[model samples]
Target chain A: MVSRPVGFEQQASSGALGSVDLGPADLVPFDDRGLAYGDGLFETVLLRAGAPVLWEHHRARLALGCDRLGIPFPCQDALDATWQGDPTAELEVLKLILTRGSGGRGYAEPESITPRLLSRRTPFQPVVKRWQEGVRVRLCNLRLGHQPYLAGIKHLNRLENVLARREWRDASIAEGLLADSAGRVVEATSMNVFWQQAGALFTPPLDQCGVAGTLRAALIDQGAVTQAALPLGELSAVDQLWVANSVQGVWPVTTLFSTNGSRLQRWPLPASDPLQCLAHPLLGFA
Target chain B: MVSRPVGFEQQASSGALGSVDLGPADLVPFDDRGLAYGDGLFETVLLRAGAPVLWEHHRARLALGCDRLGIPFPCQDALDATWQGDPTAELEVLKLILTRGSGGRGYAEPESITPRLLSRRTPFQPVVKRWQEGVRVRLCNLRLGHQPYLAGIKHLNRLENVLARREWRDASIAEGLLADSAGRVVEATSMNVFWQQAGALFTPPLDQCGVAGTLRAALIDQGAVTQAALPLGELSAVDQLWVANSVQGVWPVTTLFSTNGSRLQRWPLPASDPLQCLAHPLLGFA
Candidate 1:
């Protein structure tokens, strides 16, 4: 495990395991592993009290992602110190990016990998009020490519979301929902979608596509939601709807659009408030 | 047109106007850009001598890719110097990446954007003998997800290839060919495939999926091949087959294996000098 450094130079100079800082010079060099092959995995973590919220879960997910992408996982202590040392950062967003490191020209990977690990703190701003008031959403005309192998992980290959987001400019709509080639509702660009129907909470399964969100997984584990093979036709009958993700917690959906160009009015969530309870403690700004 | 840099530092410092020497840092951080969203397009031009093999074609494709992904065009003169200084560079591989710079954590893009432009030169080595003697290929089990919006261009979302490549460890196979969910042969991981049937050359169309390769386009323009909607069942009827890309040039297919227990017999290319007459000079290396 790599020890934490007091300053940037100390971090840079550290030959320690995962505590190595990829300085700007290394990042903007002629070839970045991130830019080269999209050869990386990342985690967007919500931090509380100068510490990462659900740090273990995030770390485990990162490890799983690395496993799926054939990247080597570093020691947990090294990763912990890399993000934990900033005393000045109390309530913030911590983004941990693990790249395969630079230098292969084409699709071929390097023989020996030097993983680039970045742990940075960002200002945490929650839109909790938006969940209460509800945020409008539109159906993105852009459909996600249906590569089953890449469906659920938060890897760096995010061009699908980029294209979907580029489809609209309306700020009124806080999110955009996407469908697969067979017209199955996948998830929103940045969040996972769940709908309440017949007194049950259900979200589309990521077995085929969409990010397997931490919050979504937690809700499913808590019996707050169940995974369903949702078709586009099933969306219209949904009584209440909400989107779940790590950063925003849970967002209630008031409206959605059907493929036939019709609006589906959404009902609010049921009495259960596990998500609110979970977010209340973890929300960085509290 | 932006002026070319004297060296790497001056280029790295110039943010959007000039080609940045891609290292580890972003002048304007694209951390949120390439990670949270895959908002970028790239082109790999094979450089022989000091000049990129097909500049006009690469430029046109890059422009088309940028338009498809809704990114602003990168400055051309800045990209020109990517291969200028290296006089001793016998063969160079130039990677050009254009990205919409970083933004807040959301799907909505920043308006009035100054896109990130990066170019890097790497030592290029081709499997020239493999192209001449014929190479082996495997049909990947992982299917390509269909998304017409992102079907053709060499955009950054390439988890599909990463996963597909991880399927095999046998170094003998040159590349893995991917098929869409519908069981139609799409293209190779890094190159496009073409087959000859009854004296007519047919390459898979990229309207639904696969990269619209510059070499493939040039081959079509040069009357070396024609586009067709290919089905996997017709592989046995193929008289002669080859894979073409900007970097690999053209590789004759001696064997193809399907992941799902299916195997293909090897077929030799036409044993005549006429093939050399039709092959591109850059493609006819070995």
Candidate 2:
């Protein structure tokens, strides 16, 4: 019941990636499992000069998420064409949402389903201010619930992140830190957190909770960091803290505080950037 | 950007609630928070002769959910109209999915959003067989992680339930049991579970995790049950087991076993029905 669009869209129709090989701007089916139960997976890739940055990592993560969620991935041709499609902007963000098509009431998956692919592009802006001067971070009262099956997957069930992000609204505070109920650090809202102590890099283990971000995974794969179960109480002892994501290479944390503004910690700019080589080289952040 | 549909939809338009008094079937905006972050709540009500059954419980629960998620409720006029709207079906299931409209990005709210509501009706089929003879249930290997802030609310982030339901596909298994990592039973994949022992009715305490089901609430409100900490291991000792929700009222358990089918427990259809008065009388199972 769908009529194909004409050609490559002049601009991503609102959130649509244009009517190119990626398909037209289609309305999300009312019974989409993604919208229904968050039964879907998504990946946000940074685009520069009409080309995607870190395309491999983003695609791999997306595929992993699709596998775990049991949602079928789009064909390779579609994935390739969608990734290469020019977003008609020098800097933009492309989001791919893969849902398990549609289903009726129960949680049981249909024997088969034609997976739905929704791609959209939005303008991307680098955070030179937060990256250079550093940003303040705070502890969220909302704790990350530990679910191993979903740990580290960038699936769409992100209410925890939304709740944590809702904890604070100071646009000035670039990021917020989240911990599991046991007081062990998990990660930051929307970004994975990293710390350097005694010249060794460490990130919170996401096996229990937290999104294993694309940048975080790449950095570790490149031997720039390691994962550990860092406790929130010991965060004050850390030498430096930073948050990383594909869209924004790295945002260094300059100050840390509690919800009541009582417990506090701070870190000064380092002698040199520790993530210079580890971050997505294409991001080209100074 | 949709033309309204007139009259009742014989078949559910995938997710469309059919164009009755709920207004036209509009396409979900691309930036909807529900699809982006599962930032929403939903309620499924059983309808009899085009009239909603247990409307107050579902509406109250939806309001509680919206309050917790900080989403504005649809005005009383809109809610009343939709709730009272005729779906033109004698026996049907109405689903209400309320999302925080659309937002730009990040977890922060958009300051203002007109909550979007999607309603759909599906044919209802009561499980008279299960209600009369207990159905088999198995323990899921996936353990729910504890998150008090999110507990007891039927938020849209239901990947845990989706994953638990994936544990088995046998049409014979009516439901799967889920528990927190501490071995405490939480609830079934969809329904809230209850047990009777020593002439006392107890349900798994939802303070740590699990959705507070509607009928479960009505039953508790009418003094039919109490909350208690239940461990999966202790379930074998219970004299009788039951699962409940507004849709089916109650499905007793004849046999309970582990995911591997190793551990087992069974209770026959007793002399008298313990849930005779508690169940929704309209189901009228013989």
Candidate 3:
């Protein structure tokens, strides 16, 4: 486990990098935009071998999200300084939160936006082995409120995730799956869902809800899966069911239970599903 | 303006109250519930005399919120002990935040919920005079998402409020008003709305959205105003407009403008309306 202090660090002169300690006083000032408006985007990257598993994708998506939220583009040099080129630090899980720095208390953002980037590292843990054994899943009763404008992107306004996560207390059930207001499955508490359908891989399209998982994004890029905007009825027809997120990597679902008393047994992926030969450098499992 | 340390006192087992030098470390032990799930409720009470304004009402609401959230109800005697008889601690503000004391990752709240309650005092400041002069108002473009299950109670999932507050940077405007997904006016960014119409007072019903402010609750109870579900377009017919919240009390709106270029004048509560005399004692305004 990473035994580092869990406080704010000093910002470098560029207002981007360097170590600054943060406390409650910093909460309201670190851009009330972040706290007051959730006007920010964040990425959680699993670092292995001194580099983020999908660093490029994480950075690119963060940039895209920043653009969407109107936050200024992040500087590479400042971001590089955050790592300090410590190759041994690859064992850490980094959570990078970029906020549109404090501006007027109102919503109209300032013309020149200064982004607040907080990069912190925690001890990394791997959950890939769990996929082979599979994990239990429960359906969350709290349906995600939909907003097409904010779907797919990882913006900070996550009260819905917070509420969904609070629905159950059973630790054995690794995750909760959420549906949109219309009862179409969206995602797990913090992961994206995918299923093997008709001998091909299918995952829900996030255009209407759910965060677009980086691992899922990578899988799609590799042609290992196709995006399907399927409703709940189609879920029963799918074969192997799995969930993936940055931190968790991927985990197979062995059991699923719905509030309406529907039960689905485990659907294992076929040998042709490409789980074995996926060539992302971070997919180190042989 | 109140000038004092932001952190509050934590009474020792000796029953002596001493200022707790709580920084980030102290807040950490309080758990992940408050930050992670927003599974809590908070109260910000203005202090006019040595005591918190409307302590009973605030306490009652906190209790109600705790009951609904499944948090343990705190001992009232211990809560009162936090304030003691320090009625002369100088005019200050009291902030109380209660959380389902932290445990369990990902939403299955712990069975034995230990509610964490914090009471801290800061100096008090009232901009009540600003209400008479009337404050500039703007309508937020970001709409409050609907969740009937979570409405009315002051739960921590406040990303909607944060997003709405970030919609503008114009300091000239005092607050931004928000509407629900159905496009009905609900409340101001941090306050509740009440307007004068045809010699009567009308405030939007909180049954579906927005917080039920203590001041608004009191006015409705005292036969001082009528509470009804009103729509955004209905405001155009109002005789005058004002916003009420726990901290800012009642603020008269002199002008209203929608981002799309619609504008309306709302000030000078008609002389015939009893709202002029409806400001409660807890409001500390004439």
Candidate 4:
């Protein structure tokens, strides 16, 4: 087992020469469009034995974000070369950020663009406990804005998520679910949510808002989940609910509460769940 | 006259003591929450004789943003002390960015937040020509998302504006107007829009989406303009139109074009438009 500190973090920036370890004090340029306007996209991936899981999904989403935002996609070979991590680590978390670099000032992107790629790695603390014993979640008072142009991509303009996540500080509440302005259940603060009804899985359609999570995409691609508009009122009728992201795998929601701490719904931790059964092998969860 | 380069830029960071000049090569920390999640607020002010125009308005808006986002407001005295600029210059632009500072990795803000204040100054290029002879604008294909929670405040999640601004590259097209997903005309890429209808000034209500511009607020407060829903269908019926911002002053729209470069409406540039007449003195447009 790797002897790295539990919360130890390391960062690097990629250039023509490959990855260069960034000193703790090294900063992003003051003029970086990312800091100035949140003009960037980021992906969080689970790395097992230093190999990134769901890398293809992350790259595809990044490429989609680049296309939508008019930022150029970084070369795959360069990204692969720069993403090398500590081979000894059994489990690690890697976050990749791609920004429109520095544009001096203003909303208009510079005539010539140089996209910057920065990567950070940390030791992963598996959510095995939360997964085994279903986690509790709350509905956020914060309703997500519907912008189809920005929906589904993991971009840096994430104040909505930040706001939703900050609504509650109760340690018992593992996550907060968010809805769109129209009262449609959209997603959890950090993960895509899915519910089972009559032996069929349904996740909220993200055409209007929410990030299209990599694991969520994989589930949909495998015909395990279907996208539908799950309104807040309809959530009570669902059989089983689960939230999933690339890094944390799948977590079943045993209890749901309103923002006011009033209990909304409760479920028993089942002996077996289809989502867990399907995701455990892929997520390497014992 | 100050002989600085036309686009020469200078940046500084403020701490307890005062603002320290940041070298061109200096970067924002890679872990800054602003870079991570666009969890910040920015204000661009017009500096004349080393003093920010409408300083109170900018500060109030910043305070509002901080309060709404739950980011701690920096001490006002520190901000005033650090805002000292080049008094010799007749006109300059100051861009103030207040981020939630370094938060290591996630969206959850650090418990003890040290909000980072970054200031950038650039030479202001007055749009006197556009102001005098009304400018041309186009309707962008991109639509702003409707999120009442994030509406009105000028936060860092500005990809919509960036996307709208990049929709046109024509030098003659001075700006692009954006509408929410529901086809309601909101504002221009970087300015608040107002129009005259039957001799009364009206601007779009930002209660749903769009930045509540400082200048727009000033106009509304002065009873010169009223907040009303301006739909895309009503643009052709308006008598005259103008876009205003803190930095650029105001520019009357002489012509409006569809995204495909087709002219939708044209208006004669009056010898003395009421908006120009009213805004000239306030904006220092001779």
Local accuracy of candidate 2 as per-residue lDDT tens digits, B1-286: 1322222111233333334334335456567888888899888888887677878888889888888888776665455444454455567887778888777466777875667777677778787787777789999999998888788888889999998998888878889999899999889999999999999888988988899988888878888899888877799999888888888878888899888977488888766778745665734434
Model 2 lDDT per residue over A111-164, tens place: 776677776777878877777788888988999988988988888899989888
Model 3 CA deviation exceeding 4 Å by range: A1-41, A64-74, A81-91, A97-119, A148-150, A221-224, A260-282, B1-33, B36-39, B81-91, B99-120, B265-268
Error of 4 at B109 (Å): 1.7
For each candidate in turn, the TM-score is 0.87, 0.92, 0.80, 0.92
* Candidate ranking (lDDT, best to worst): 4, 2, 1, 3
**Candidate number that wins on DockQ, 2 or 3:** 2
- Per residue, candidate 4 scores C-alpha lDDT tens digits across B109-160 of 7777777776766667786888788899999999898888788998999999
Best by lDDT: 4
Q: RMSD (Cα, Å) of candidate 3?
A: 5.9
List, residue by residue over A36-145, the lDDT tens digit for candidate 3: 34567667777766566777777778877766566666676545544444444436666566666666523456665666655555566566556557778878888877
Q: How do the candidates rank by DockQ, highest first?
A: 4, 2, 1, 3
Task: Tell the DockQ for candidate 2.
Answer: 0.70
DockQ of candidate 4, scored on C-alphas against the true complex (2 decimals): 0.71
Each prediction's RMSD to truth? 4.6, 4.3, 5.9, 5.7
Q: What TM-score between 0 and 1 does chain B of candidate 2 receive? A: 0.89
Residues forming the 10-long window of minimal summed lDDT in candidate 4 chain A: A1-10
What shift in Å separates residue A79 of candidate 3 from its native position after superposition?
3.6
User: After superposition, which runs of candidate 1 have C-alpha atoms over 4 Å from their true positions?
Assistant: A1-28, A87-90, A257-263, A266-286, B1-32, B84-86, B123-125, B260-263, B273-276, B282-286
Rate residue A256 of model 4 by lDDT: 93
Kindly provide the TM-score obtained by chain B of candidate 4 when compared with the true chain B: 0.90
